[model samples]
Target: MADDNPGFSDPVTLFQDVEDLKAQIARLTGLIDRLTAGGGDDPAGPGDGDTGAPAQDADAEGEEEDGYPPFILLLDSPAYDEELRALIEWVEGVLVPGYLAEPSSDAHWCHLWFEHPVAVGRLHALWLAWQELTEPATCGYTGPSTWHRDHLDPCMRELRGRGGPFGGCTKNEHQIAHRQPSLVPSAWRMAES
Candidate 1:
């Protein structure tokens, strides 16, 4: 039967080839997970603690001084006008107020300790939704989801180097739209109708 088709290969060789491919895929997947999950380091690591000394010194120095580290917000894309507006509203109304005040206020610092994975996961979900809404080829282009998964570090670094938040970090759009899911009803509903 193998000889009947000119393109046919040996069954044992095919099986071996498939096994090798599977092994390689597994290895690659493990690597991706490690790389994405803060490379084995704790997401909310030691840096988040208030050393107390420096802050106290700064407080003693001057209350009006620019002591607080600036905030960073990473948006997935500018194309999803409705969702983008909704996200901006969410940042201003909900997320910023909830996370940037009181006990969790330290999380506002880009350099401070944080649940990096959780933040990254949330950004990733937003990125996915953004891709679905903007990219015509995406499965949910006309569906509900409207966010994308944007990496914060690069965007933050760019913002820092620019000396302000208006540097236009749109260059990282590709990275922002990766590793996202196809559907996100909550995000879709959150967008302006």
Candidate 2:
């Protein structure tokens, strides 16, 4: 008799469970639709896009789940390995390419970094930091903000400083003062692997 809140217990709980299950079903249905129907016009489907992460709402802004362009992988996410591999590929494939090509400040005009030991180590750490600072709900700033302020600026200053890695390839009169300070091309090539 004391448990007389009977209606609040079983039936209500069952109803709540049913609602949750329904919501999950609806979400899963949407995923299947996207995967089967394609990301856009092409019939190749969302998997064809394969940009690693799932698609985001074109209208949504500042409320992204993984922050932005540089997504940090959460172990619970199904796309964990995919996203991480993508990030690694971008850093190696695109981000650090300039450094390998020309390890001078003149290479990219004031922010380029050469593939020196110190530079490579710093950029690797910077990349990792980017992943951490851009977590969906953890960091204080947005992705670009965190990258420029926290990871990019400081690391760039250090890695391209007059005494920093890449021998501080600062743009003086727009000339590469030194022709690649350290870390021979062969070494950087090996590191790329």
Question: Top model by lDDT, which number?
Answer: 2
Off by over 4 Å in 2: 1-88, 92-115, 140-143, 168-193
Worst 10 residues of 1 by lDDT: 45-54
Please write out the lDDT profile of model 1 over residues 48-105, one tens digit for every residue: 1121111233232222232221112332334233334444554455444653433221
Q: What's model 1's overall lDDT?
A: 0.35
Q: Report the lDDT of model 1 for residue 160.
A: 33
Candidate 2 residue lDDT tens string, 1-193: 6278665667756765565455446535645665566545543332322223336442333223322333332232444445455555656775667433444543332343333434445655676565544443333334445456667777766755565544534445333345555755697788899
- Give TM per candidate: 0.20, 0.33
* lDDT over C-alpha atoms for residue 32 of model 1: 51
Residue 5 lDDT, candidate 1, scale 0-100:
75
All models: lDDT? 0.35, 0.49
